[model samples]
Target: MAFLALQKDGTQRAWAAEHLWPDCTPYRAAGNLRSALCHARRACATPVVETIGQSLRLAPTVRVDLHDAYRAGDEVTAGLSPPPGTENGLIEALRQDLLPEWPEDWLVIEREQWDQLRLHVLETLAQQLQATHRFVPALQVALAAVGIDPVRETAHRIVMEVHIAEGNVASAYKCYQNYKDMLERELSISPSQRMRELVEELMPR
Candidate 1:
């Protein structure tokens, strides 16, 4: 179901079955898919999955949280605020990983895709908030990105930017030093020249 949702065009039933049940024989996989589809249909009050002639897809009417988060991310990336009433949950939505509890092998790529997408979106959203002078939420969102990937230089950079925007020079410098040390300890490498330059501007000559 999630695989189908990720695909722009719904996938062929055979392809989905094969991907979802890679270890099973094709015949068994197809049977498993059918059963799962039926179960999904019955479990939902409204349709969650829909079948066409030879393909299956998430129902057009289904409201998926990841999809909503992607739309919100796109809005912020485009410099537009998310629609009214969505502000409260935007951070939480961005914090989520795609189906973390599901241990299916097929989910690996999907999870990575969402992880990268959400990280980009979160960083962008935080920058947008900072640019608008919404410092509190900006720092919160930036820190959320850092929490997701501690070694991600971009996320750390944004954290520093948020601190600087709030007139917290000491905090910003501390953040840079901490990240610099983390990179050395974790990756045995130093921060990039771009990061160093950002921090250099913060230093008094």
Candidate 2:
């Protein structure tokens, strides 16, 4: 819940005991809440979670890397790539899934949201690279998107587009065919007409 609050606003948030301890109302008496807050403060080497007037929040000094990465990914998606020397690191950061080991319901929703955000960042970067005629990196980014979610047709489409733009018509056809087969096998459905037309446009005369 602390994580969720920080993610929502990147600041300390005040939540009533009822909000934080929804399942344990009987145990949320003033003395018990004070003891719990003290224990929380002691559990960490430095002060982290803090209580203020019957509400709880992380200390002002704490900063979370996950939030930073999320903002960076958003910036990249909005056409603000990192400086030249840092592009590789930024791309690697964008590739990571948030809290992959956590099984909590909120974390599950956040994971899916972050995954889609990362996919969008990759697709945007790939398109930017393609516009600059940097075909190799463009293809790599598109391929990474497909690896993250094979069922995402836009990623596969981007891969095929990169291949065709690079004069690899045969590779483009093969990519489309492979995606077509996967869709048919996994979902019992055919690729969309737009995807089929893209391949057709790249077909050798």
Candidate 3:
């Protein structure tokens, strides 16, 4: 079901069976796929999964939350306002991992892809909010990105920039110090020169 959902163009039953039950024999995997398909049909009140010839996909009318998030991120990157109520909603949505507790090889790549996309969108949204003096939500959005990947320099940079925008130089400096320490502790590295320059600009001559 997830395999079909993730694919925009749908997938062949043979291909999906091979990937989903890679450890099983071809006959066993095909049997498993058929059983799973039956369960999927029985679990839904309306048809969520659709079959076309030998390919499977989510029905066109089904709403995928991940696809919605991707669209919201696209709107942010394209310099468009997200639909009503989605500004803060996007922040909350990006804060979640795409099935973090799911332990499957196929899921890992999708999860990582979502993580990267959300981080980029969060940072961009934070910058947009900051440019318009929406400092509180800017900070919230930036901090959500930081929470996802603490060592992401861009997210921390946006965090510092948000503080600096509101004349909270002390808070910005503290954020820089924490980020610097985290980098050292986690990756045995220092914050990049760009990050240093951002903080250094706040210091008096």
Candidate 4:
């Protein structure tokens, strides 16, 4: 499945048999490649995978979550607000790690790319919620972003802003202090000056 996914795309969907099995020396001698392709064709009863001129192509009916998530994230980043009542589910889907169990280098790279993309999406969603004065959901999205990448200062800052907007000065201060402690303990560094200023602005002094 992974191999086929790696090969498929909108413009170029087919992969030559030679490309799929570069070393046909042994397999061809034993007729293993032919037998395997035959079984694969049979297994794809719905015809999602079809042979075209000695190459395999995935049908348009096939859809991948990774692709869908990316497209949605792009749309969100491009200022397309998600429909009401679907924010939580969309956020949850974006939070999922891509192919966590896969140890392949390609999978690792793609996973990291998706992770960053989702973080951006989360941050954007939080900002949109904050703009609309939806502090509760904004806070939730900010916290989820922080949970995914604890060292991301933008998420921490959004969380602080949401708490402050909700009139929870104490909670905002506590969140800042916790972030400060975590940064110091983990990276031996303090929060950014801008972040410190934000907390100071909320102080009673």
Candidate 5:
């Protein structure tokens, strides 16, 4: 239910009413929200919901996986290598999205959040891989991220930049084109000037 709510791109209220209580009438929906929270709390050891008047949110105490992954991504972006023992912890954090098997229509805001975080994790992982001269593996992670969220231009940009830095002009240009085509197809948008210039530099006349 939390994943359903978080997957949507809006406030929590809509998820409570829509996915959580698809059969609920407007008059009884608020009560249903409370019931759902109660049930979720019973099944989990932690507080799942925090009540604040008419709005109910995931409890402040929850340390969500995606949030942890974002932090790990940031650390990687800052060029911090994970210690040998900690690699599993960082990779484990990004290996899955919560409630993958559940399908719920809830919000547009959350989908964007997931996309942004996915892009961050992928780009960070790619950077780390490239730093160690693992070009093929870096591309795999970066490209997989782009596949997961085609509209996220940054994933492709990260791969392209890494390729350029590695002196693989061909790979950089290919990644840039892939990004450009994806953006145009998914969002009807063009690549940013920075992306365009890098790709152009790689292309031979």
Candidate 6:
């Protein structure tokens, strides 16, 4: 399924066959590709590969995270405001990965591009939602952005501040804890002192 997402539309299956089985006979490679693609579809529960005169595309119905991220990003660039509460969904809809467990291969390059676009668009949505005083929705978007890219400290802080402002100290602390744990466990690092200090402060009742 993921192959369809990563592959360029209209590429000859022979191109894919060659890559998948570099050492094998071209006939064998082409046969393997067909089998692999069929298995991929069943496993992912989507028809990710479509054939149109020896060319392929991801299934038309399979909405990819990268695609949604790009579309949402375009909408924002065109000054289209997202419906309130939908901003976070938009961010979440732009899933952190198209197929996270897929083996690391040439697709890493495409993954990196998707990663960048998803973060950029989600962060933009977070900021826009915040400006409109849709604090809960904004917080969700910000949190999603941070999840997709934990290095985005600004997005994390924004979620914290929004929660505190809304008098949801528990939620604010949970956000802090989750992010703090992720960094510490995954990267062997701690949250910034500024983040630590902010979480201790109380919100107005």
Query: Whole-model Cα lDDT per candidate?
Result: 0.85, 0.75, 0.88, 0.78, 0.68, 0.74
Error of 1 at 99 (Å): 1.4
Quick one: RMSD of model 2?
3.4
Q: Whole-model lDDT, candidate 1?
A: 0.85
Model 1 lDDT tens row, 1-205 = 6777786567899999999899999999999999999888788899877788988878888767777777778887777877778776987888877778989888898888777877888888888788889989988888888888899999899889888888899999999999989889988999999999999999899
C-alpha root-mean-square deviation, each candidate: 1.9, 3.4, 1.4, 4.0, 5.1, 6.0
Which segments of candidate 1 are over 4 A away from where they belong?
Answer: 41-47
Q: Pull out the clashing pairs in model 4.
A: none
Off by over 4 Å in 3: none
lDDT of 4 by residue, 107-157 (tens): 656677878999999999999999999888899888889988999899999
The candidate that achieves the highest lDDT relative to the unseen native structure: 3
lDDT of 4: 0.78
Better of 4 and 5 by TM-score: 4
Error of 4 at 133 (Å): 1.9
Model 6 residue 140 distance off true place after TM-score fit, in angstroms? 2.6
Off by over 4 Å in 2: 1-6, 10-37
Which candidate gets the maximum TM-score versus the true structure?
3
Global CA lDDT computed for model 3: 0.88
Q: Which ten residues in a row have the lowest lDDT in candidate 1?
A: 1-10
lDDT of 3 by residue, 1-205 (tens): 6677788778999999998998999999999999999998999999988889998999999878878888889888888877777677777788888777778788878888889999989888899889999999899889989889888899999999999999999999999999999889988999999999998999998
Root-mean-square deviation of Cα positions for candidate 6 versus the true structure, in angstroms = 6.0
Backbone clashes in model 3: 0
Per-residue lDDT over 1-205 for candidate 6, one digit per residue giving the tens place of the 0 to 100 score: 5555666454678887786577879999999988997787788765667788788777777766656666777787567876666665666667557567877464677778877777777777777777778887787777777778776677788888888778788988888888888888888888888988897575444
List ranges where model 4 is wrong by over 4 Å.
6-39, 50-57
Residues 1-205, candidate 2, lDDT per residue (tens digit)? 3453445443222333443344555455444556766777778898877555544666667876666667878888888875688667767877776767765544566778878988998998898889889999999888888888989999999998898888898999999999889998999999899999998787568
